[model samples]
Target chain A: MIPVTVLTGFLGSGKTTLLARLLKSPEFARTAVIINEFGAVGIDHDLVEAGEESFVQLETGCLCCTIRGDLEATMADLVARRADGVVPPFERIVIETSGLADPAPILNAIMSEGARGSGLALGGIVTTVDAVTGLATLAREAQSVRQAAVADRLILTKSDLAGEAADLRVRLAALNPRAPLSEALFGEIDAGVLLYTEYDRLDDFHTHTHHVHADDIQCIAIRRSEPMRALTLTLLLEALADHCGAGLLRLKGIINVAEYPHRPAIIHGVQHIFHAPAWLEGWSTADHDTRLVLIGRGLSEAWVLNLIAAIEAEIAEIAPQQAPAPL
Target chain B: MDEALLALITSSLALWERAGDVRREAGGAIALESEGHEVRITRAAPDVPFRWSITIDGRARVASSVPGLLRVLRAGLDPDFRPSRVRIAPIGITPS
Candidate 1:
């Protein structure tokens, strides 16, 4: 599956500035960009200097709300064009959502059945939070909060202009404790940081505390030393989706499956949509413990922990009964 | 075992942010009432392959696992609930 990264933030949050910098870097040489603008006339494309053959501008409406179908269709068209050699063979795709858009629906589009069938996989979410007005925006805008909450990486843009970002950093940490924050001055930052999508090296997973924000958004991390049964993991995800619904925003983890000791499974989900577990060749480090980070609204850390324990206990009871007898 | 199961059910209700009450009934069955809906959960007979029998609002269904039970409960309680389907894809991008 071709990996697709989503670039999202609130209005004037420096999404285009970051994209322009990324496009100039050699790391994004073989990348295709889909820039979604909310208004009638699209100008973000003009500001970006990517190869025209691989660049797409969606000016219909907000990619999250009105033009979701268009987004899917555009992706399919890009894949078809690439296969037909109509455009450059881009290794990955980056979707820059409108500043005002809620990224959940756009993410759903990329992970939708049609997009998956077209060989598209979610790479990660990169949300740009303007340091000057980020705190105020996050305070008043629900969309901004959701963008920051679901981001895999949060970029603090224009930090040079807005001195003393300590307060904003604290606020962002409270809202999303797992996503690593990077400061970008004049949109100049290491391009490799934004392109790294592998979940194997989740160093930030160490923050295992439950952080609850005023908007009912919270981040809960679950860690277990014992390996979990694959069935238990499946059932746990199913139960979470069935009950939590949209309240469960983003869940990503590296699970140590009992059946596969050496090869850990990488799981990711946005809202109700979850990608199937991806098995790694081997554990990245000696730490093979299961670490899961859930960012959402009104999530209970104890409940999730208890739920996993209950499922594991049930599995243990049934495994013995279902074991094959010795011949 | 029953206590853990009851705790899970209660926590499940709380996770959904719904006002509900879960209590053990007379015959070792669990009863859940929320938003004018009634649910009864009982262990299946030893001879049956299913693990639990769940009856919601006079409708009966058998769940072979805890996940199945949650699905049934969500369908009965939340009218707009849709189970998120997981799809397996290739782990990473294959360069052309």
Candidate 2:
């Protein structure tokens, strides 16, 4: 699967500076960069220098908004065109989101929307925090707080210009004690830490998992022992999309579709936009049953359980004879 | 395919916002009605290579795919819609 990394921070968080430096790295070479701007006229593309034909500029409102469809289609088109020799063949994709972006949905889109058979895997979330004003920005802007909250790695930019960050570090740790924090001085960070493989590290798995109590964002782990009909999963996502809305931030997990038991399906979604379900070759986990982690705002585990049961029951009564084909 | 086509149309109508109304017609066809113009979209014949025939101002335009039909509909309907020119950075240094 192709790894897609998301780079997000507040305005003037020095994302561009870090991106400029990153583009020059040997690891980032052959990377397809997507620069997303919030306005009508995009200027971020012009500000940074990447591979001339590898950077895709997405001025689709915001990454978390209605224009998420654009993001999926763009990636799909890129993949399709690349296969047809219409676009350049890049090894990986990197999305640089607008400063005000909510990284959860954007990450969800990448993880989910690329879908089954899209050959895309969620890499990691790297949030650039402005060391000079990051403390005040985190306190003032809720978006910045969320961006930092969901990141796997937090890079404090402009650290050279700042002093005494004990308070900021404390606040960050309080908000997100899991994300490994570092400073991006001279617009440089060790590439391996940001774009690392083996995302499923057992030792630090809890660190990357969403577990913020200070913030409303918390993760709900949904574990099912029995194999689920693929249709049930689709209906569940649809029901959640209709009911949850913004309350549902990100959903990710491996599902054991009843029909395709050998190949587990990877499910992902950001808000209402659910990516096409990707089917893996085989079960990665030793103990198979479905396992899903939902990080959201005010997510009721009981309500979700009831909804799934209700939908499954309704489907069973309506079409008891036959289970719909695996999605 | 039908869902994708409908989504594209639905999203475009949302973008248009009150400029035109899109509704499902009988026999799995879609009809978009604006002030005086009505564009009927129906799946083309199986033998035909095109996917859809978008009828606007009593003229029909054939589009081979979903995106093609979208372009045709936009050209016929919305004046403000300008497709963003997507630029993919050229291939550069490869990683070892």
Candidate 3:
């Protein structure tokens, strides 16, 4: 699966500078970038050099409103072109949204029906906030507030110019307590932490996880290798969806199941809506363990652990009855 | 206001009040309308992609989802809610 990272910010939050720096890193060497600018004239497209025709500009007046279909088609075309070797090889994809654009629709398009089979999956949402004026802009612009609210990572650009970054950090924490806030100097940041590669590899016997540190929120990773019954996973997901839909930001994992050993299931969820579980032809890697990362507001790790145990126990009880009648 | 229109006004008033808005009225439709600036929003056939119709000065525009409907309504209600095109710009170094 190609991990697609979404970069967004309010007008002039320094998203492009950050992208330019990130692309130079060896980690992003094989990455394909799609930048959306908010004008008929496309200067951002000219600034970045990735591959010929790889830089796409969405000149539609309002991308968030009028260009969702266009965005979907563009992604499809990119996938098709890549498969046909028409474009340079890329291991990852990054999408930079215009300053005034809403990131949610773009996210929905990626997770929607026709796009899933194209081998593109959402990596994470990174929002850039101008350190000097971020707080004021967020106060005035509802779109900016929502952008900060839904971010997986918050990048504070122009931190060096500020007398103090503390006030802006405090404001961001209040808006999105679950996202990690990082300071950027001259658009330069450590790509490893900024990019979404938190948990790339897996080990079945042992748990491999990343603990996302948030202000009052915590992202908990639950790793289990024991083969889980299908019904157990269903029950757990149902409970989560029903009880904590709004607070739940995102969930991503690969599950090892008793019924399907050869094919591990890829599961992801945003709020109450859970995407249809996808079964991979083979494990992304040899480690057969189940890794579940849950990002939410004020999540209680103990509660989640108990909930999983309870669901598994219920499944254990139901499995005996679910056994097939004698042939 | 018609009965349904009055009720819609009442409910919207309640909703607006609950959401901390100051005032709402049932004088006319706020979005797409054929005769005037009033628009009618009702459920569309299940098979249709859009579930709502917004008529602006007798011109009806269908919307697929609530968000889409709201977008139209907002554009009509607030002139500043312009949907600007997206452009490509380098993520820059800004003053903190």
Candidate 4:
């Protein structure tokens, strides 16, 4: 599946500027960019330079609202064009949404379509925040808060203009403690941080831990060394989606399922939307523990722990009763 | 009946890069003149799916949606703009 990274932020937050610089990277040479502007005309298309085998298509409308359907349609079109050799063969895709938009709907469109075998996987979400006024925007707009909350990597832009930004860091951690926060010096960002990987990279999980809490948003990490039954994992996620809904901003994990202990399952979810379990061919390390990082508002780590234990016990009870005698 | 449509048109203009300014004229009519081209938009009768009639370069066209209308305007005013076709996926993806 081709990985598609979502780049989002608030208006004047320097998303386009970062994208313009990102396109120039030798690392992103084969990446196709889809630029969505929140108005009748597209001004961002003019700002971003199209590189070889790389072109930016503009979606005209709010990404979170009237044109969300268009976003899905656009994805299918892009894949078809790539298959037919109408466009350059790109290994990945990057969607840059309008600054004033909510990112949840856009994320849902991609994950749902990707599950249909369009050969697209949600690479990761990279949200840009203008260090100068990011705190104000987050305080004023729910969309801004959600945008920052869902990112896998949050890029704080124009940090040179702002001093220290210690308060902004604290607020960002409170809103999304799971996502590793970094500053982009004048739109210059490291491409590797935004690209989607197989969850093998230890660096991603090791980068941060839950440090601060605000706005009822908190990051919860669950790790169990015992290999879990796949059925129990599904049951747990179903319960999560059934109960959590939109408060669950994002869920990412690399799990060791007992039924498929040889390979690992990469789990990703945004609110009620979730990608089908992406089965990896192999494990990343000798330590095969299940590690899950969830960023959510009003979610309880204690509840999740109790729920997992209950399901594991119930499954263990039933498997023994239904077991076949050794021949 | 068409106040929302007018607001969308105005907001779209403000967001688009090439667009200059949107002007509201007498009788609730709206006009946008940018890059030496003028576009006048008014809501069409309710019977048609195309909700609005847009007149540009002395030629009139009907648009069924805001995105459709944006296409019409881009075709008229932006010489470098090219329209891309979009289609929905064939099957629904499920969480396995």
RMSD per model, one decimal:
4.4, 13.6, 14.4, 19.3
List ranges where model 1 is wrong by over 4 Å.
A51-59, A67-69, A113-119, A198-204, A209-214, A321-327, B17-40, B54-62, B71-96
What would the TM-scores of all predictions be? 0.85, 0.60, 0.59, 0.73
Question: Global lDDT of each model?
Answer: 0.81, 0.69, 0.64, 0.74
Q: Tens-digit lDDT track for model 4 on A48-127?
A: 99789798888878878875567778888899999999999988889999998888888878777443468787778888
The sequence of per-residue lDDT tens digits that candidate 2 reaches over residues A190-212 is: 77666763234211243222344
lDDT for position A137 in model 3: 95
Instruction: DockQ for every model, please.
Output: 0.31, 0.02, 0.02, 0.01
Task: Candidate 3: list runs displaced more than 4 Å.
Answer: A24-27, A39-43, A46-54, A59-67, A138-142, A170-180, A192-198, A201-227, A239-248, A254-265, A278-314, A321-327, B1-96
Give the least accurate 10-residue stretch of model 3 chain A, judged by summed lDDT.
A198-207
lDDT at residue B60 of model 3 (Cα atoms): 66
Error at B78, model 3, angstroms = 32
The C-alpha local distance difference test score for the whole of candidate 2 amounts to 0.69
Q: Write the per-residue lDDT of candidate 3 for residues B39-60, one digit (tens) a residue.
A: 4555456788765566544566
- Tell me, by TM-score, which candidate is best: 1
lDDT of 1: 0.81
Residue lDDT tens for model 3, A154-226 = 9999999985778778777766655678889877899985556423422222434445544434566788777
Runs of candidate 4 with Cα error greater than 4 angstroms are A113-116, A196-203, A207-212, A321-327, B1-96
